[model samples]
Target: MSEPEELPQREQRESTKKKKKTKRSGKKKKEQREGEEQVEFEQEVQSVSECVVLHGIFKLGKKSHDVLLTRTKLTWTPIIPENPTGETGVPQSGEVLLQDIFAVKVKRRRAAGQESGGPVLGVALFWCRRKGRRLEEDTLHLHNASSEHTHTWYNTLKELLTGFSNRPTNLKVFINPSSHKKEAVHIYRDHVAPLFKMADIRTDITVTERKGHVLSVIKECKLDEYDGVVCVGGDGSVAELCHALVLRAQLDADSPEKPVRATLPLGIIPAGSTDVVSCSVHGVRDPVTAALHIVLGHLQQVDMCSFSSHGQLVCFGFSAMFGFGGRSLARAEKKRWMPSSRRREYALVKTLARLRPEDCQLSFLSARKSNSNLFVQRDKDQDQDQDPKSEGEESWVTNQGLYLSISIMSIPCLSPHAPQGLAPNTSLANGSAALIAVGNTSRSEFIKHLKRYSSSTGQFNFSFVETHAVSAVKIRPCSLIGCSEDESEEEGDLKTTPFIHAEGTTFPWNIDGELVEIANEVLIRVHPRLITLYGEEVEEAESSVSCSCI
Candidate 1:
């Protein structure tokens, strides 16, 4: 009986030990699955058909990594050594897109006393990473001891970079030293030039001394030597360049009948008080962002307007303003001795204080309207009766009245004052222009209208405001003595007289932030896809600052 009892106790102990071992095995399996899942989550899935260009072992920092180069990206995974248990550690892989890479060079390790020669280590990659609205540069180094391996990798990368045909290798840069607060030169040197150099881009830089220096250089310079033209200044400088480029194209074509599209694209670096053109193009007034856009070869074809007076081409511009806008710019030009911000503020306040409207006639050729009532059925019989050619003709709309402001914009004029742009409904290559007309309104109401531009909506909701999509516009300002009887009656009760120029006097017009004096009627026509600019389309422009002068 004692022996049987001892046997039972032994059996029970064996059973308990077996159960504990089973539980431990199950826990280990669960942990292993989770680790596998984590690795899968961290690694980008590769296609079976994707071709691997190169694979090698490289040292990253103190750890060895397995590097693989594919057609689209470069990936690196850390090598984890297996322990005595035959279990390996998980790997967290990283990758960089080939398109984001701007430059690659051989990394060298030099001795303290050595200045010229050094031993080849590996390759260093320079790239740009998007951070919020801007791009920041980053670098990665692959360490290796073999010089031949590093040279091979460098040559492969250089060949790959050469395949990007859109990237500009040579550029002509114009810097305006007098733009804004006189920081254009510094902005270019500190932000733009370094990026261009890193990308191995050759640039011919010209520091503009006077107002029209850029235009003169553009006219005489050998444009064939450059891939593009870069303007490092404000909107005026950009407009001047645009005009010069268009003129150069016309000269090259030797045809006055119609203007040809600009051959080379233009890049703008914002370093001014109001960088509307740059903001409109790049969606932000940032020099680094602009430089990156150019290096990456982002192209956007934008519509341009040709401003003509008395059948002579005055200039080519993206936007123009008359009436109150012109008066304010004119005032700002006179106060050149003051600081840019102060001058703009003073001009705005003074112009508003002497608020007045201009009597003018506006004739615009409207763009074809899309029928909003899609559900409505068209009468087949009526459609058959209409002439087919007549359907293609867009009718001209005419209106004559007292207007406080008139704006014709081919590109959305975006700035801090107007975050949504002065013409929010317009697009870059829409083949049309936004014609905004501000009819006669009280000073307070006009101020309200101006303030609404900073908001997202309700800008053109007032009864006195009108907006139209036009392809061409003709504006004729009526002299004070030539005003209609009803117009003269409307001006009788105003506390201040209308700010009208004397007979035969030149009228001020604000064309892309530059003041122009025109003595006769002006005609503006939109040319679609006229010039290629270095930027991407901006769906919505954002601004952290707002105008406080109001």
Candidate 2:
């Protein structure tokens, strides 16, 4: 060994071997750490209830929870402590965390292939409760495997009896399984029920039947006892709720017995076809995110508009319209047979096919000071004495080419889906209204403007469109002086027609995507911001009703 070069060579080889071994060992340790971290994976938990479910186990990441759940069902049995936790094999530590909780954990048999036949994921879960707060986290719970398909957590064991959570809200939920789709129930049970259990929210769920069925339930609700109304449906369901609000307001109008109507925020679950308002307010209508919004919604005032079709309390919104772009909506709805995209395409084609010049007399109170009345009155007194019967069926002909649309908004954006982005900045307390006229020059102009609206990149060119901040507007077309036999009978037709010094009615005015006959006159009184709707959606009508009452 002392013989020089040979000894040096051996030492060099050993040193190199040692380095290689150490590197391999360090790499193995790194791999192990990585696996551990994977077990620790989690989605950002916004729900405090969810955080509680994972109590005393920060070491077990959300992914681990999933893994544990998956193993028991799709793979292996759930992990159990060699010594059981709590009364039912749950660690005593599990009870310690839940000691602060007071919830009702409901258990029911899974419907035939339907899981917890209840609103829960067909697996029983109680809405959770915790003291002293409104917001809650989505939670997780552990269950024991059983031989019977009907076993439930409710009334099954002592631990279930003692370790419950308490909360503030008495919740009542209405789910229209057919709101926009048929799978709404399934979506609610799976994602919503777990959090309900962990947070221990008290809930009563009723599936709806028939159209406007929700309205019927809410009409009879002890509205004060329940803190909020959560509808697991789509816009139509939301519309029903709005109606309920209006009806409640109407009933309470004269009675001092009326409770101070606070804006009861609505919770929407996106289980529908066109969740336009939900998407507009919250961006994407994820069930989880929407549930989060439900927890987060606060009261803010938004504007409302009141209108009458001859005086029968017709409805209008902060955004009012009855013209070209609106007709496109009617057109789009017709192509319901096609996929939404295809329907949109066909609507665009038809709209282009029907653009033409229009003429009419429009009168409104000028935004500027003038020796004028507080209304728009045409100087056409000659028509006062003209034979009313002469202007009949041809009346439709006169108004034909001159389609009109008017929109009144407190802010520039009138509605959540008005070819504009969501969250239309509406003020419910501001009592102002704006009127805009959409003019039809030619098919080319109509096509150009419609395309702009569709792309969400258009602006109002005052050239063809005139906008006025005003109190009232009256429009009458002269092209159809003798169009219909009914029109020839002035006394009969004028009473229900769309125009009158104060009583015209027979015209069809489209209000907020709906059409109503003004069989009489219309004096659109702009009742400044009158109602509170955060994401106004269709609730704009509630304020409209209030203003019309005024």
Q: What Cα-based lDDT does every candidate model obtain?
A: 0.83, 0.45
Residue-level lDDT of model 1, residues 1-550, one tens digit each, is 8999999899999999999999999999999999998877656454431468888999988999999987678899999988899988788889998888889988888888877768898999998788766767889999998998888888987887787788899999988898888999999999999999989999999998887787788779899999999999998999999988988898888967576788999999999888998888887888998999899888998889999988999999999999989989999999999998789889988888767888889988764441211112211122211111222476667899888999999888888778788988567776667888999888888889988988887878899888876678889988875433233345333533455557898878999999999989999987877899998877556687776978
lDDT of 2 by residue, 431-550 (tens): 334565666454455445544533344435436655554445555543433223223333211211221222342444445434444444455544433333433232221011011100
> With candidate 1 superimposed using the best TM-score fit, by how many Å does residue 365's alpha carbon deviate from the native?
0.7
lDDT of 1: 0.83
Pairs that clash in candidate 1: none
Q: List the candidate 2 regions with Cα displacement exceeding 4 Å.
A: 1-168, 176-178, 181-187, 190-198, 206-208, 255-263, 271-276, 316-318, 332-336, 356-404, 409-419, 422-434, 454-457, 468-510, 515-550
- Candidate 1 ranges beyond 4 A from true positions: 1-49, 83-90, 111-115, 369-392, 481-497
How far off is model 1, as Cα RMSD? 15.5
Best by TM-score: 1
Task: Provide the lDDT at 513 for model 1.
Answer: 91
